[model samples]
Target: MKILLDTCVWGGVCKELEVAGHDVVWAGDWPEDPGDEEMLAHAYAEGRILITLDKDFGELAIVRGIQHCGILRLVKFAARQQASVCLHVLTRYGRELQTGAIITAEPGRLRIRRPDEKGQPLTCDIQGQGSRCELRRDGAGTYRLLPFNRGSSARQTASAWGTGMWEGIKGAGSAPGSTAPGGETND
Candidate 1:
């Protein structure tokens, strides 16, 4: 799996994935902050999954129509915690993510919307129109993020994250990169 990691994905996860050998690149390696739009564009153009910690990309993907081959947004976790969740997602669900999916990881729960899965697929009739889905971890089932906030006068907030199982990803996780992916070619 080729992944373009956001600045929020710090060293521990970076090292873990790098050692796992998944061809990962960092946003900070760019000449400057590539910004969400440009960063996402780079990932899409290169067929890489854009993994971000900032949830703003979720909003941008819908409102600005940014498309990415795949995306993983790690919500509300510290650097180490984020890394653990990412490792689990990549190790346990890497194959599931290959086909243009929007995956959100929030501690114990993970939610994703793949191109042809089933209920509530992102309406991406063409390429470069990203798949969109953000889910809150609910007991026994998943819940959408936007609909839960839309009816309120004040915006609702999701809870903070927890640490995850990190046993296997150390041995093999999706790391993806060589040249700085922001400007250089993915190869």
Candidate 2:
């Protein structure tokens, strides 16, 4: 599969995918950071699957109704996991991800949310205090927090999830002329 990878998942993962005969493109290879919209556009244009560690893509995909081949959103996992673990995860489940589904991988758990899935409000007990979150879309086509906390913002949480998902799809390698930092444009 032709895959566009976010920087977080490209550092050491691209190589593995390449070895497996999958063509991979890192953001650094692109001309720019290519925000969620542009990235999805490029992927769709190139007939590639987006392998990102960003949950915002989910919202972007929903709001714009963009029909991407697929999106892999990493959840949470230990940073020290073995590379083989990543290979196993991706090899076993990568095909399922091609259907525009979200695969979330935790330490020992794996959950999947389809494109048609709507997030429900979650309430958890935090040291006897009630913490609630309603994962709904706002008027601006972004996310709105009903009543969350200050410890971690929604965007951060989403990025973290993206990271884990990327980990599960793991492979390694730096694309040529695409290793520059901070989303610099190639052209």
Candidate 3:
């Protein structure tokens, strides 16, 4: 695969991808920053997947409707983990990358955004741990993160997480935290 690593990505990632037999370009190596839009354009023109830590590319692609081969946004990952995670993502979602899907890879989740046949953006979230846990808004307007047991029902897993964990979703607490298990806090 051909990849364009954004300036924010660790330079070591380029070497790792190269060792994995991928054609890699690190934007950090450039003499000057051509800016995000130009970088995105260059990646699109070259048919390379743009790998970045920036969220702006998603807005540019989804809101501005810019054309691109694909985008993989790695969020909150440490520099040492970037290369392995990048390879893992490529091994798993290479097809999506080839077809222009915007994928956000986070701690233990992957949020995939792609346009439907009608050009409407559709999102699919997959937990990197294996199974999926969906965040849904209830009729009462509260958000619940529903975890599922592999062979069982969603209700079964709810009890495993317990009510306190669920209650944490209601509003901001005295301290910043997460409702998801092993998840990162926003602040």
User: What's the TM-score of every candidate structure?
Assistant: 0.59, 0.54, 0.68
Winner on TM-score between 1 and 3 is 3
TM-score of 1: 0.59
> What value of lDDT does candidate 2 attain over all alpha carbons?
0.51
Candidate models: Cα lDDT each:
0.56, 0.51, 0.71
How would the candidate models be sorted by lDDT, starting from the highest? 3, 1, 2
Kindly indicate the candidate among 2 and 3 with the higher TM-score.
Answer: 3
Model 1: residue 12 alpha-carbon error in angstroms: 2.8
lDDT of 3 at 76: 96
**Model 1: number of clashes?**
8
Clashes of each: 8, 17, 0
lDDT of 3 at 11: 97
Model 1 C-alpha lDDT per residue in residues 154-176, reported as the tens digit of each score: 12211111112111111111111
lDDT of 1: 0.56
The digit string of per-residue lDDT tens for model 2 on 1-187 reads 7777775564566777778778888786666575778888888888777766677876677666777867765555443442344565467556655766555444433344456556521111111123333223446533222334435553454334223112100111012223212342111
Q: Evaluated with TM-score, which candidate comes out highest?
A: 3
Top model number, lDDT: 3
